[model samples]
Target: MPSAASSEAPSEASTAPWDVHRLPRADGKTFLVTGGNAGIGYFVAEQLAGTGATVVLGSRDADKADAAATSIRSRVPDARVRHIRLDLADLASLKASAEALRSDRLDAVVHNAGVKFDQPDRRETGDGHEAMFGINHLGHFALTHWLAPLLAAAPEGRVVTTGSFAATSERLDLDDLESTRDYRPDRTYGRSKLAQMLFGFELDRRLRTGGSTVRSVVTHPGGALDSLTPPRPPLHAPTTGERLRGLPAGILVQGKEAAAWPAVRAVLDPSVTGGQLWAPRIFGLRGPPGSGPSAVIWRTRRSRPACGRRAAT
Candidate 1:
């Protein structure tokens, strides 16, 4: 167990009142961030801990999660953060992770863990579902179901599912949810993300119908690259092509810290309501976070060019 501590003292060099450096205080709150060991997830945990939230990092790798917690403590000296092993690719692991949550009342959960397909070969989980859909959708489905009770008990609870713009172009095939017959790596990933967004929208509807206070929303960390993210354990130093790609993209893409803003807002901001989609301000890419149309909105609005044609609306 990691030692508990109060929030870190704010910095004196703060620029704007609404800057990521100056979030509204979250003292005494408790939240969980899945895939909290790396990329956007790591920064989300760090930011939440800075505001006085007890952050539980749900990760498949215990050592990596511990390292992330240590890094947060190093940056925010008094930050309260801990790690619990959680493998989202496996259903049994999700159940165990939910059961092991130490907090009696969880204020929020940020579902951020996922695979960025870099290979052409298809993969599947032990349960025989496609790896991307299994981890990104079904795994989270079970985890959220298990934790919904705890969330409902809190005065205000939230579930933030991280989605992608790719979802807008991909249609989910209920008849072939696993993408078994035809699996193109990138398209399958898009389908999985779309499924996640669908789940978020559906969850909000169900919560509203059931008169539950637990809100569900979706967010996308646009153009967040591994090159801009801080190093994690077992670092595979960027390849030559990746380094070349990073140099040009660094100008256009937001760093992991900046990309984390939308997710952070989804988890903590009071103004953000259920079923909203928060995204980056510039080109939905690199800038401060802001509210965007939800997937439900995209489904309904055909006037928008990007959403004019729909295979899965």
Candidate 2:
């Protein structure tokens, strides 16, 4: 429901006329998107609000979160959008937000908060997990778990986790999850994404097996350019990878576009079964939304995201 122009940026491939724009409003559905202030998260919040769904922009930064909600309301004059503070790195804040939400049932939740290799120093959150694992995976894991009861109250709820193709290079090191002894920024970020993907897969498997009606889906926005994403070829190395060699790093897709395609598909696409992975159809994963491959990274023996698979109740 964001302004049609908000997501109108061109993509790496031919752009679609955003049928999402025409979809009817989601009158009764209520959604919460973490990191919903900037980048893809903001776009997701805006679009959902455009559908007339009550959107809660869960954000870590108080100011940014407020600004995002304000912008969404501005874009959609009647949008019933609001903001909530949720520092994923801190469980206390996540819990407080869960308790404060007035809605008893959440129609869907999009876990999109993440950080890449910007900071080289190893970081540990309040919960003591590696900064990447803590914020990107476990923080979300705990938040979702705390809200599962509310989500389950809905007849057909869904959970969407944003992952990245960068995860392909990741392998979880449970023993070194905190990265206390060694710090490799890029690899750590990859590990965080890997955790998210596995958590999605694991969440799906458990949900299906438990016969829970609530659906869980995962998405990987591959090759999309964003602030969190490394520069093409990564400044650390200039001439690597086919996608990185020449593509105008910024031309891949706008954060809004990259997020819109996948977020819309994940929440509204009828065929989007639980556990499905959605990405762009074109080279950048920046085009029309379509199912994409779940990387083999989560399948490897080293993945330690099993903890995320645990069921509530």
Among all candidates shown, the one with the greatest lDDT: 1
Give the CA lDDT, 0 to 100, for residue 120 in model 1: 86
The digit string of per-residue lDDT tens for model 2 on 233-268 reads 211122346335445645565444455668766887
- Range of the 10 consecutive residues with the lowest summed lDDT in candidate 2: 1-10
Superposed by TM-score, candidate 1 places the C-alpha of residue 241 at a distance from the truth, in angstroms, of 13
lDDT of 1 by residue, 101-146 (tens): 8667899999999986759888999988899999998889999988
Clashes (N, CA, C under 3 Å) per candidate = 0, 2
How does candidate 1 fare on TM-score? 0.84
lDDT measured at residue 155 in model 1 versus the true structure, 0 to 100: 89
Candidate 1 lDDT score at position 11: 22
Flag regions of model 2 displaced more than 4 Å.
1-18, 226-255, 295-297, 301-313
